[model samples]
Target: MKMAKIGLLLDEQTANKKWAERENVFAFYMKEVLDHFGIPYQVISENTDPMEEMDLLIAGLLNESDQAVQQLISYIKNGGAVLHLSDSPKLARWAGCQVDCGGPGYGYPAKELGYQKPVRFLKTNHWYRAAPADWNAKEGFLTDGSPEGPVIGELWMTIMAGSGKMVHCQADLPYSIVGLQQGLEPIHRDGVPAPDGTAGIDDGLLKADDSFTMDWSCDRETTDTGMNYFSEAYADRWREVFYHKLAEMALEKGLTVPFIGRWPAGIDQIATISHDSDFNLEESAEVTLSLLKECGIHSTWCMIEPGYESGMYKKIKQEGHELAYHYNALEVENGVWSEMEFKRQLQDLKTKTGLKHFCTNKNHYTLFKGWGELFEWCEKEGIQLDQSRGPSKKGNIGFLFGTCLPYFPIAWHTEKNRKYDVIELGFLTQDLNHHALADTTVIEPFLEEVQRIGGVAHFLFHQLHLLEQPKVGEAFRKVVREARARKFEFWTSEQISRWERARRRIKIDRLAPSGEPELSGEAPTASPVIWVPVPKHANVLGEEAEIRFGHLCIKKIPVFKQAQTS
Candidate 1:
């Protein structure tokens, strides 16, 4: 039996033009998620791509191209499984539905798919409303307020077409994922006040909070008045649903979907501890460094300009931790958000420490302006990762930027298919010690959810508060203990950057006759583990790996195999 693979049909001409105009590149974001999960797939074009060779097809159609529509309908009619990622009228008609785009707004999942957070559907021309009774939807989106309200549209529906299945999404899946993660184009600064003495807002700059594009007011009845999301990592759960559906569809077709697990050696999940050196205080930095060493974990210390004495830098390097850059773009500190200023601080950190390279950076006060500009600067500076997109206020702590995983952001206002080289690992929140709202309780749930979805759980701390604030020190210890209890490995930002980049080079060569996937590429320092979803009675010819999440019998395979080229 031939192993199944996912085929992503992308309308490049239309997607390219849309991306250039700062529109959601549906294909790009969909592919981004697939690549992030290490799902093996082939990019197909509508004109001459072979659809029969694919076990499942994900159609990312941006326009109502007649040729593409006809091709998809024919493929589905001829017993081909299709997962449509567009609201094209022709494709919707084939799925027995009508397109009633009742303008852009928030949408709630009518039925729970393990995630109940309202997904944002703010795309300009392609927003949707609930499908009518005639649509015969299996699962759909509801009005923002309640699931009993008017049906917005089908969230996930399947129709049997010519002995095959057509799974459809009413809203644009790629757009929703991209919008939730990257956030909307910042128009004005959000007026939310920062913590006392914090430089989050009122600084006359577009801080990270200003870029929040998710509707925090959607599902807030359960939480206290101060909190926004009922739960965190909304995008992470939604992505898991997508992955589950893919596995379900593949299983239905008597096939298995293969992907590389996020972490190497089958670690349950990953936890990263990073400290922002705001004041460049040596004593506080030493305190945190000692605590980390005591816990037997390596961390990333983001250094501000004139960061530490040369000896302090040498000490940090001598330890198993990472010395990174902390870009000071806060105006109150006389910082400027200019490219020249970014370069100056980075250069200063490098010069002072005699460090030839810095892999990660987090802006002072989580400051950010515009879309993709900070990412562009990081890429230009040869920095591999950034951590400036998390929440600064109390209400929005977990998954504020919609994900804890490291993702390469796409260029919104630039040329087509342009994605930055830098990886964004948005921290969950800063200093769990400061607020009653964000305390030690947030750590376990966040790590659980991240483990459930095979992503990272990044916790941020401040060097100044570690010892001066005893509660802060306690909170840090609690995080480490809980994560360690859950078998989560602690890694530095540089380690994550290197691992992600290395895993991206890995590709599924082919399925062996024994039902194991053959992988090709240079394995990371820790060998990569490939996950294969095994159906009942279907043998997975490999060692069964223990993972924290998923009901399916996921088998793990080695990553050092050579490609079996025909």
Candidate 2:
């Protein structure tokens, strides 16, 4: 196997040290992309790369010195691949497109990555627009001996320097993406004021069924990854753009890779029928439980603060239904309760229900407010899973991370410094929408798309929706029957949370540089449904592994054997 060395070049002026030290979204998500593709990489700085031992070097908006620019150009011309994201004013002569510094330096609205975005070596003509078009560089400008003129098209140019290739891509990707992910106003993407404090819930808004909707938005260009949910949304095409580019770079260095899907098992889609226990579940528990029983579904029931052990406890314990906790956001927002109160709440629930610990969680208002602090509480309080990363502010309902599968969040933790895996199951397509806005029309297409892509199709329903809007009982029944008809995996929230932890622990290893690496851990037990993705082109060396789309599904083996060749 050939080893490929990829280096990330950094500029001092723009490389924020704090962001680098704390939660560096760029580095975190970039590594996620690389690891998914089985590509290994390292960070390279100006002072670093002395011997120039890299096959490819990636850099941000190049605002460095003239000497620094020439050094990279020389490397590329000498047979190295250079991916210069956004503009590089210093490399105007070689790149064939110069940054239009005379044009607006900033104040441009951000747009999603488009298919027509021009590229050089990439086989696909499309791209993921992580950042907005802040740089105004005209592509394919015919350069005279010195003077620049006759700029043609959106300035994305490519040049051949001896045996090497250089591409002046006209979009600022990682830089702007980081800002957007952190709920910041993407002024560079859209000329807007800085992010006004955290998004505020609407005062007098409620769904037709009287269920709460978390529809939020910012004036600036926003993404589901952030808070703004109600505003005009932009499609996050990161998967397509990043995957294509990574494959392109690897092929340049001689490597093949496959796209990673969300769901693990052969299950194309996942559906969770969750009932939020805002009202006293012990008294009214039979109502929701009977509904699930009628639908042939064992749903997840989450409680606000279980005060006493009642019929609900016996049902959850004996009936195979899952138990979870819910925090009331209105109590906190209205200053009626503090976070510390949850500690007592957990104890009260355990005492009443005789359940030692709780694992999964949702919120009263489906609020992600103070989630970081809430996660810390979850850790100290023994909560393992959180299903709160939804993208609704107060009226409209949608996806947050836009996936159905569960994942450990990287908001505060890094790879080396670890804590418990805060499994975030992205909640998409809630039940409130069907009655509130007749969004049943909007759901079928999404479910079909999820099936096509082999993703999850999770839906949340408040007990109030069932108790108050008795008219929409058929709508809920139809969704469950359809899911059963499709054979989608029906797991309780607790089951999903436990399964995700087990999934993460089973590390799938592959070869270095060529997209697959090594696994270093073990799962408590091999599950028939437990599946881990391996490289599509991986050589399993006669190992008993199920290969689908290059993913070697780790079968249930009592003894964990290292795949010597895979």
Candidate 3:
């Protein structure tokens, strides 16, 4: 596929680098913006020759050399699209564009542009009629304004220019600058009339107008608008700009193009669920099993053994759901339970409920204190998996330290000289814990990480929380539906165990390790438990009300006599 070339000119000196690194500013926007457009772009020092033949040049705030400035002029003259973010107007003026100051007073430069004044579109007979009306206008000082400030004409700094053309504000357009043409076809941002029949906007000298008002009825108020919220309109504008830049670059280079990703083929994703209470498990298990049956999705559910409701264990087993123990040993606050007691309780629960495999509780954020001890116990007890690694606050210590993907726990000889069969299956970020640090927007990047590493994404959530809020439930359902639609196979914990066992056997056959005796028969076996409950509620023909669970319906016999006879 033909890829469009994009170059970023930024001044990454020591001081700026230090500041950017601390805040993760550049890294966050740079990768996201590039990925959004599917455009392959490279960042270069501000001093690099801008006149070099390229599809688009994004000059940062510090490219000030006369030669470098002239190079940008040449780039524009050669028909290359240029984006100057924050302080780039100085270079813009050198490129023959006239900048007129709009709005009142000098404003502070924020990371993303924040406008204070209402920007009214003059609506000249220009090409960009499709642009959104009434932008929140702010001031950009005129390129050649006198020390005092009134200018004849105002430059309404709106993103969309003429003929569906849009210039991204703050210079750094956040979207994939490549693949944009392929994705958003027919929309281009290059070579529209510059509002003035000239090559670029004129950099006329002007003075600021403190009392300019297009509408006298509207009060002029100044308030700080926070971060840009996600909107379809914004996304569209970004997509358009990205594609236009890419198309312009593609035309410059002779290359064959192909669309990204195979259509109709599913993209792989991981499905997971968290278990908090036994009632939570029972409800989730029933719903999940039914949903999976209907949609053919495999999902994992984390279980809290002691915390689970009575009779829930057998139900989970019958439904073929994976069971991982949720450990809250660290969160007791009083530190009442000892390491030995925790292990004993887990083993006892396993024996009583017939659950062989399990994972720790999400409450272990306090510390990973007893993880090593737990692993030792698992090795002795023949428990197979432990999906409890990752950040947590309830647990004072982290557990299953080494492995990222599922793997056998490193053998640590205890004082008692015992081995364990526990393998640590890592989790994706904890929903509550991580969300407390970032926001929902981070979910996409997290998914990308999982895809990149070919890892299973383990998500933990409280059923109560999900069910309590309709919006949250809908969002949760949407994420799951989207993931499934993308071709991710969901496996219950039991299913994962089965797959892992089969995978291990295949590996064993391939390796045939010395001193390790080959298994003479199929893997270990356990009887499946099934529970059948008597029907308590039923409908009868011509009956106005439903029959109750304890009450038997009979039209011919008196209730007292029938009970006595029985």
For model 2, the local distance difference test gives 0.49
Writing each residue's lDDT as its tens digit, candidate 1 over 119-234 gives: 55544223333543544444545453343445555566667777777877656556656667776565356544433333244546677767665544452222333333325555
Ranked by TM-score from best down, the candidates are: 1, 2, 3
Q: Which predicted model would earn the best TM-score? A: 1
Q: Which is the leading candidate under lDDT?
A: 1
Q: Count steric clashes of candidate 2.
A: 26
Listed in order, each prediction's TM-score against the native is: 0.88, 0.66, 0.37
Model 1 has an lDDT value of 0.72
* Per-model CA lDDT versus the true structure: 0.72, 0.49, 0.36
**Can you give the lDDT of residue 245 in candidate 2?**
48
Candidate 2 structure, TM-score to reference: 0.66
Report lDDT (Cα) of residue 152, candidate 1: 55
Give me the runs in candidate 1 sitting further than 4 Å from their true place.
Answer: 16-22, 94-96, 102-148, 191-203, 218-230, 435-437, 536-551, 562-566
Q: Report the lDDT tens digits of candidate 2 across residue range 1-566.
A: 34446766654444454345753334334444344333446666565554178776666434357777788878887888776664555576454443542220111111222322221111111122334433333222212111122222232335678788775444444432222222321111212212354332333322111222112222222333332232211213333344444445555556433332344545556778776776564545666777877877777777776432576578666877887777664644442234677676667777777789888777565544422556666878878887765634323344333334454444442332223356666565466444443344445544554554454566777666666676456667767767667767777877777655654444434344532334445533433232333444556665556643223443322234443444
Q: In model 2, how large is the Cα lDDT of residue 405?
A: 46
- Give the Cα-based TM-score of candidate 3 against the true structure: 0.37
